[model samples]
Target chain A: MKILVGIKRVVDYNVRVRVLPDGSGVDIDGVKMSINPFDEIALEEALRIKEAGKAAEVIVISCGTDECQQQLRTALAMGADRAIQVKTGSALQPLSTAQALLRVIEREQPGLVILGKQAIDDDNSQTGQMLAALWNRPQATFASKLVFEGEKLTVTREVDAGLETIEVDLPAVVTVDLRLNEPRFVKLPDIMKAKRKPLDVIPLEELGASLASNLDITRYAAPPLRQKGIRVENAAQLVQELKNRGLL
Target chain B: MSKILIVAEHDGHTLNLSTAKCVSCAKAIGGDIDIAVLGQGHDAVGAQAAALAGVSRVLMISAAHLAHPLAANWAPEVLQLAANYTHVIGPSTTMGKDLMPRVAALVGVNQFSDVMEVLSPLSFRRPIYAGNAIIDVKAAEGQKIVMTVRTASWPATGSGGNAVVEQRTAQGTAAGHSRYLALNSAGSERPDLQGASKVVSGGRALGSAEGFALIYRLADKLGAGVGASRAAVDAGYVPSDMQVGQTGKIIAPDLYLAFGISGAIQHITGIKDSRTIVAVNKDAEAPIFEIADIGLVGDLFTVIPEIEALLG
Candidate 1:
C-alpha cells in the first residue's frame, strides 16, 4: 500500500560536459541540473499506481545536497504526497546511496520501492538492488511493465534477447525502464499545490549512516582520441585501406 | 586462491552471447573461471557455461524460485559467493546493470559498470559523456574486482565439451518488493543487437516508424540483428529497446550497416567496434563516414533498396 520512489539530481542531458583541465572531474559551471531522466519514469510509475488506488501513499525520496530539494519538489508536483530529502554536501556513490536509502526504508517500511534503472551521470544502476539486499527483499530490475495482484507483483523485465516477466511477493524493489510510461507534465495548478505540501529535510549523519565511498577513484583520464583516417578517393581506395588495416 | 566468478544472465536454459563474451574477458583477466547459473533446470545452462573455453567450474544455483533473476535475491547470493571467488564479472545488460552494483555494494566496493576495455587487472576504460568521451579509471581499493563488460568488443569463447556443476542454495529474502509477471519476447531468430557480429541499423532520416521497420527486413536478409541510433528511438521511429548508442545499448558488430544515420559520437561509440562499418548517409560529410569501412554518399532510400537487391 505504501510506495517509495528514489530520485536523483543529475546534470541535464542536453548540456555538453567538459572534462576538468586537471582530469579530476567534470566542469559543473553553468550547467543545467534536473532529476535523472530514468528517475522521472520511476516517479511517473509510482504516480500512476497511486492514481489507480493501488497505493495508499506515495513518497518521493532523494539524497543529495540542499540543491536536490528542487528535484524532490518536481516529484511532489507531479503527484507524490510528500518528499524526504537526505542532505549531503558530497556526492555519494551507488553503494553509499543504497545504504542511506536502507536507513529510510527502515523508517518508512514501504511495501514497494521503485527507482530508475540507472542514473545518467554515473550510470551505476545498483542502488535499488543494494537496498533490496540490505532489506532482504526481492527485486525486479528494469521493469517495462509492473502490475500488482493480491500480495504478488508481476513485472516485465527487459533482457538481452527479449522481454521476460516474473512474479514475486510484495515488499519488493522494481527499477523502471524508459518504456514504462511517459511522465505527465506538472501543470501550474499542481505545481502551486505541491508548494503547500510538506517536505522534510534530514541530514545524512542524522540517519546514523556513513556516506563514505567504499571504492577509490584513484585517477580519471579522458580516453585517447581515435586514430585519424586516411582520405580515400573511391571505393577501390577504401578497399585498399581496409586490406591494409587487415579489416578485409 | 581467488576464484573468478562469471554471472550467467539467461532466460534459464540457453546461454546468452554476453555470457560467452564475459568468459573471454574473464580469461584475459586470468583466473579459474567459475559460472553461477540461477534458474529452474539450470543443468543445461551450467553445461553451456562450463563448455566455454577457459571455464574451470560452474556454480549452479538452481531453484524453482530463481526461474527469473531478481537482483534483490541474486545480490545476496553473490555476496555469499564472493567469499569463495576473488573476482566477478558480467555483461553490461540491463540485468547486470541492476545486479552488479548491488553485489559490489554488498561486498562494500563501488562497481564499475559498462567497461569497454580492461587496461589491466585493476585498470579499465569506459565511455562517459554519453559515449562522446572515454574515461579511464583505476580501482585502487577492495580485494575483489567487479565490473560489467560492454559486450560486442570482447571475443566470445568457443563452445566447449563439458563443465562441472555445483548446486547452491538461494537466500530467501522476505522483502518481496517486485515480482515477475509475463514476458513478451521480441521473438526474432536473429542475434541480439548487443551480441551480434553484424548489425544493420536505421535512423529517423528514414522518415517514419515504418521506415525504421525496413531495418528488420534488411537484418533478416543479412542474418543480423536490427539496431537504431538514439535519434530514431527518441523520435519514436523505433522502440527504445532497439536503440544503439551510449544512452541506449552499446554494440560492436563485425559488419555494421547504418542507413540514414549521421554519426554522432554517442551513436558511433556503440558501433565503433564493428570490423566493417558501412554508412549510407545523404550528407557526405556525416561523422559516421569518419570511421566507416564503406561510405555510400547517397540517400538511404536509394542505396538500401539497391543493397537489398544486390544481396538478393
Candidate 2:
C-alpha cells in the first residue's frame, strides 16, 4: 500500500497579519512562512502508519511555487520515500488543486490519501472532502483516530456535535485532525539526507489539470473594531447599567 | 432582484442551531431569504424555517432518499436551487463544507467557507490564521455568491411566523461517485459542545483519562457538556470528542466553566464568546482569568468535587 500526504506552505500561525498597502491582499513583505501546522499533523500520521509497517511507501505532495519545495523536503526529511511538487507560482484554488491531485492519484494509484482537515491561511476545510468527491471515494474527515484492520479503516471524526466513528474500505481519503498523532521533529541527520532524496517536479500542464481561477476579490479591509466597553465598579452598577441599556 | 437561497440543515426534526444563525446573517446582508429543506416529511421543516425571524419563503424538496445528507447527492440540488437564487447561504458544518464547494464550482464561483460576519452584501469577515487574525474581503464579478457562516457568533431563533412553502423537486438524487457505507454515532447523551449552554472543560492538570470522569461528573451534575483544553486532549487525558480550542470546536455557551485549564490563546479563541465565564485553576497566572467573569484560584481536584457534592 502507498500513502500520499498533502502539505502546504502557509504564513506562520503566530504572526499577526496586516493588510497590504494596495488594499488587495495581506501584507507579505517580510512575514515568515512554514508548513501549515495541520499539514504537519497529516505528514506525521503518514510516517507513523508506515513506521508501524502498515504501508510500503510514503509520498509527500504539495502544490505551490519554488518556496514550497522546502515543505516537501521537510516531509521527506521526516521519512517520506519521495515527493512530488506541482509547480504553480501562484496558489491554486481548492477545486483546481483537487483536479491536480486527482491527476496525480490517477497516475500513482496510491492506496490512501491523507491531508489536514483545513489550511490555516484560507481556513477553507473544503479541499479534502472536495478531493474525495472528485475522486469518488469515501472520506472520513476530521479524523482523530484511525485504526486499520484488514481492508477496513475505522476512523473517528471530530465534529461540532461530538465524535462520529465511520469505517471505509481502502482507496479512501482521510483528513487528519489535531489528535491523530503528535508530529515528530525532523532529525538533523535526516534533514541532511533529505537534501539528496528524490524530489520530482511536475507542472499542472503535464497533469492536464485545469488552472481556472474561480473567485475574485474586489478589495481587502479590516473588520470593524469593537466599541470600548464600560467597566462597572460593582454588581449593583452592572445591574443598573444593564437596566439602563434595556438588556435587563 | 435576485432571490437568495438558504439551505436548511436539520436532524429530520428541529433545525440545526447554525441554520437559524445563518438566516440572521442572511437577513443582515439584505436579501429575500428563501429556505430549501430537502428530506422526507419536509413540509413541517420548511414551515419551521419560514417561521425564522427573517425568512421570507420556504422551498420544500421532500423525499425519503434525501433524508441522509450526502454531499455528492445534494450538490446538484443546490446547483439547481442556485439557478433560481442569487446568493446561497448555509451553516459551516461538515455537510456544508462538503456540499458548498461543488455547488459553487458547478456555477463557476468559489464558495467562501467559515465567514465570521458579513460587513455588506458583497463583503465579509473571516478568520485567516486559526482565529489569530480577521480578514475582510469583497466578492466580485458574480451574480451568485455562496458562503458558510461560522456557528458560534449567531444565536438560534425559534421565532416562527407564517411563511409560504414552494414545493420543488431536486434534480434527481445526485448519484455518480461516492456511496454511504456506514455511520457509527458517538452516543455521548450530551448536548453538542458548540450548542451547549454550559460547558465544563478540563485541562492537562486533570492528569489522565480517569481524571476526566471527575469533570464529566461535575458536567453531568450541572447538566452541562464536557470540553477539554488542547493540552488535555493532546495528552490523551480526554477523548478528542471534548476538545475545545482554535483548531478544534469553537463554542459560545451561555456559561463556560474552565477547570484546571491554563488557557492558551488558541483555547481562549474557542470560548471567548461565552456570556459568563468561570475559571477554577490552581495556577493564578493562567490566561483563562483574563476573560473569566469569575476566577477561583484553587486546585480543580478539590474544587470540582466540592462543587459536584454541593450541586448534588
Candidate 3:
C-alpha cells in the first residue's frame, strides 16, 4: 500500500505574525517559511508507516506557488520517496484545494491519505474532511494515534470530550493532530540525497478541477490588544488587588 | 431577511454551553434562528436548546447512529435541514470542527470557522494566526453561508425563550465505513475548562506528572478549573485536554492564575480575553508577569500552599 501525505507551506510557527498596514493580509515579506507544523507531523507519520514496512512508498504533495518546492524538498529530505507540487500562484480555497487533491487521488489511488488537521496560517481545519467528503470515503480526523490492521485502520482522535478511537476501512483519509509524533530533523547527507529524488510539478489547471474561492477576505487587522497591567509585590498584594476589584 | 440554522452540540445527556454561545453569535447576525439537535434520547437536550433566547424552533433528530457524533452520519441530516435556511452555524468545538466542514462540503458551500465577529449578514471577522491577526471575510452572494462561532468570543445566550420543539427522523443511512469504538475521557468533577469562571494554569516548572496535583488542589479550593500551559502538557505533566494555549483550548475566565508559567505568546492568546490575570513565578522577568494584573516573584511550590492556607 502507498501512503499519500498533503503538505502546505506556511509562515513558521515561531515567527510573530504582523498584519500589513494596508489591511490586505499578514506580512510575509522576508519572513521565514516552513512546512506547516501539523503537516510536518502528518508527513512524519507517513514516513514512519513506510519505514515500518507497512507501506511501499510515501508521496508528499503540496499546493502552492513555485516557492512551495522548497518545502517539498524539505519533505523529500525528511524521507518522502517522491514529491508532487500542484503549481498554483493564486490562493486556493479549501474546496478548490480538495477538488484538486481528489483529481490526484483518483489517479494515484493510494490506500491512505493523511493531512494536517488545520493549517496554522488559515486556522481552517477543513481540508481533510472536505477531501474525504468529496472523495466519498470515510474520514478519521484529529487522529492522535493510528494503528494499521490489514485493510482496517484504527485512529484515536483528540475530541472535545477527550480521546475517541474509531476504525475505518482502507482508501480512507485521516487528519493528524499534534500528539501523533514528533517530526525528525533532516540531516545534511539526507538533504544532499533528497536533491536527487523525483520532484514533479503539476499545474492546478492541468488537474481539470474548478478552482474558486467562495469566501473573499476583505481586510486584515491586528487583534484587539490587551494592556499590560502593573506588577504587584507578593501574594498578599495580589489578593488585595483581587479583593479591590471584587474578583476574588 | 436571512434564516439561520444552528446544529446543537450535546453528549446525549446535557447540552454543551457552546451551543448557547453560537446562538448568541447567530442573534447578533439578526435572523430568524432555529437549532437542530441530532442524537438519540436527546429530548432533554433539545428542550435545553429551545429554551435559549433567540431560538424560534428546535428540530430534534433522534437517531441511534447519532449517539456518537460522527461527521459522515451527521452531515447528511444537517444538509437536509440546511436546505430551508440561508445560513448554517455551529460551535467551533471539536465536534463542530469535525462535522461542520463536511456539512458545508455536502451543501457545496465554504465554511467560515472561528467567527469572532459578524460584520454583516455575510461578512465576518475571525482570528487567523492563532488570534494574532484578525481578517474580515465575506462569503459570496447567492450561496448558503456555513459558519462556526468561536465560543470564547461570544457570551452564552440567556434562557428565556419559549420556542417549539419538533421531532424529526434521520434522513439517510449511517456511513458504514467508519465505526466508533471507544472514548477514553478524563472524568473530572471540576467545572469545564472553557466554561469555568476562574482558571489556574501550571507550566513546565511543575516538573512531573505528579506535580499537577498541586494545581488541581488549588483549583478545588478556589472552585476553579485546572488548566496547563502547552509546555506542561507537552512535558506529560497533565493530559492534553487541560492545555490552555493557542493550539489548545481558548478560555475567557473572570480570573486567570498562572503558576510558574513563562507566558509564551501562544499561551497568552488563549487567555487574552480573561478579565484579570495573576502570575506566580520565581523568575521576576517571566513574560507572564508582563500581562499579569498582580505578579508575585516567588516559587509556585511555596506560594500556592500559602495562598491555599490563607483562603482556608
Candidate 4:
C-alpha cells in the first residue's frame, strides 16, 4: 500500500501576515515560507503509518511554482521517499488544487491520501473533501485518530458538536486535525540526504487539470480594529467598569 | 432576485442556531430563502426552521441514513435540490465546513467560506489569515454561489413568521464504504460555546482538569458558555468541544472574558470578532491586552472570586 501526502507551501504560521496596501493580496515579500503546519501533521501521520509497516512508500506532493520545491525538499528531508511538484502559479484555489492532486493520484494510484484539513494561509478547509468528491471516493475529514484494519479504515473526527467516529474504505481521502500527531523536527543530517532524493516537477496544464478561478477577490483590508482599552487597577475597578457597560 | 436554499443543521430534534444565522445572511442577499432540513424524524426541527423570519418554507428531507449529519449522503441530496435555487448556503460550523465544499464540487463550482458581508448576490467580503485581513470576492456571472455563512458575524433572524412545511424523501443514499460508528462526547448542560452571547474561556493556566471547576463556577454564575484555549484542551483540562481557537470555534459574543490565556494568534482568531473583550492574565504584557477592551494584570483565581462576590 502507498500513502500520498498532499502538502502546501504557506506563510509561516508565526509570521503575522499583513495585507498588501495596494489591495492586491497579502504581502509575501521576503516573508518566511514553510510547509503549512497542518500539512506537516499529515506528513507525519503518513510517515508513522509507513514506519508501522502499514504502507510501503510515502510520496509527498505539492502544487505550486518551482519555489514550492523548496518545501518539497523539506518534506523529503522529513522522511518522504520522494516528492512531486505540480508547476503552476501561486493563485490556485482549493478546487483547482484538488484537481491537480487528482491528476497526480491517477499517476500514483496510492491507496490512501492524507492532507491537512485546511491551509493556514487561505483557511479553506475544502481540498480534502473536494478531492474525494472529484475522485468519487469516501472522505473521512477532521480525523484525529486513524486505525486501519486490512481493507477497512476507522477514523475519529473532531467536530464542533463533539468527537465523531466514522469508517471509510481504502482509496479514500483523510484530512487530519491537530490532535493526530506532533510533527518531528527535521535534523541537519536529513537535510543533506533530502538533497539526494528524487524531486519531479510537472506543469499543471500537462496533467489536464482545469484552473477554476471563479471567486474574484476585489480588495484586501484589515479587519476592524478594537479601540485601545483602559487598564483596570483592581478587581473592584473591573467590576465597576463591567457595570457601567451593562455587561455585568 | 435570487432564490437561496439553506442546508439546515440539526440533531434530529432541534434546529441548530447556525441555520438561523444563515437565514440572516440570505436575507442580506435579498432573496427568497427556503431551508432544507435533512434528517430522520425531524418534524420538530422542520417547524423550528420554518419559524425564522426570513424563511419562506422548510423542506423536511428524510431517509434512514440522514439521521447522522454525514456529508457524503447529505451533499447528494442537496445537489438534487440545487437546481431550484441560485445559491445554496450553510453555516461555517464543523458540519458546514465539512459538507458545503463537497456539494460545491459536485455542482462543479467554487465554494466560499466565511461570507461576512454580502455586497451583491455574487459579491461578498470574507475574512482570511485568521481574521487578520478581509477579502472582497465576487463569483463569476451566472454561476451558482455555494457558500458558508460566518455565523459569528451575523445575528440570528428572529422567529416570528410561520412558513409551510413540506416533506420529501431523500434521493441520495449512504455511501457503501463509509459508515458512522459511535460518537464519544460528554453532553453539557451549559450553553453552546458558539451561540452564547457571553463566553468565559480559561487557558493552560487553569493548571489541571480539576482546576477548570473554577471556570465552570464563574460561567455558571454569569450565565455564559464555557470555552478553553487549545492548550487547555491539549492538556486534557477540557474536551475539544470546549476549545475556542482558529482550529476550534470562531465565536463572536457580546462579552468575551479570557482568563489566564496568553493570547496566541490562533486563540485570538476565535475571539477577535467579539463585541467586547476582557482579559485577566497575571502577565501584564500578554498579547491579549493589545486587543482587550479591558485589561487587568492579576491572577484569574483571585479576580474571579472577587467578581463573583460583587455580582452576588
Clashing pairs in 4: none
Predict model 4's lDDT versus the native: 0.91
lDDT, model 2, position A195: 92
What is candidate 3's CA lDDT for residue B261?
A: 94
Give Cα distance to truth, residue B196, candidate 1, Å.
2.2
Cα shift from native, residue A88, model 2 (Å): 2.8
Look at candidate 3 and tell me the lDDT of residue A22. 90
lDDT of 1 by residue, A47-120 (tens): 88988989989999999888899999888899999999998887887777888888898899898999998887
| Candidate 3 local lDDT, B1-312, one digit each (tens) | 989999999988899999999998998888899999999987899889888988999999988888888898898899999999999999998899999999988888778999999999989999998888999999877679998899889999999998999998889888888888998889899999999999999999999889889999999998999999989989999888888877788888999999989999989988888888989999988988878877889988988887887776
Candidate 2 clashes between residue pairs 3 or more apart in a chain or in different chains: B51-B161
Better of 1 and 3 by lDDT: 3
Q: Give per-residue lDDT, candidate 4, residue A139.
A: 91
Writing each residue's lDDT as its tens digit, candidate 2 over A17-80 gives: 7766666777777788888888899988888889999999999999988889988898899899
The alpha-carbon deviation from the true structure for residue A118 of candidate 4, after best TM-score superposition, in angstroms, is 0.5
Flag the better candidate by lDDT, 1 or 2: 1
> What is the DockQ (computed on Cα atoms) for candidate 1?
0.38
What DockQ does each candidate score versus the true complex, computed on alpha carbons?
A: 0.38, 0.32, 0.79, 0.81
The fnat scores of all predictions, in order, read 0.48, 0.31, 0.78, 0.80
Interface Cα RMSD in Å, per prediction? 3.4, 4.9, 1.2, 1.1
Off by over 4 Å in 3: none
TM-score of B chain for each model?
Answer: 0.92, 0.90, 0.97, 0.98
lDDT of 3 by residue, A1-248 (tens): 88999999999998999998999888899999999999999999999998899999999999999999999999999999999999998888888889889999998999999999999999999999999988989999999999999999999998867889999998899999889999999999999999999999999999976755469999999888667687776667777778899987
Ranking by TM-score: 4, 3, 1, 2
Candidate 1's C-alpha runs over 4 A off are A188-194, A228-248, B119-123, B136-142, B159-179, B208-213, B230-240, B263-266, B283-294
Estimate TM-scores for all models.
0.88, 0.85, 0.98, 0.99
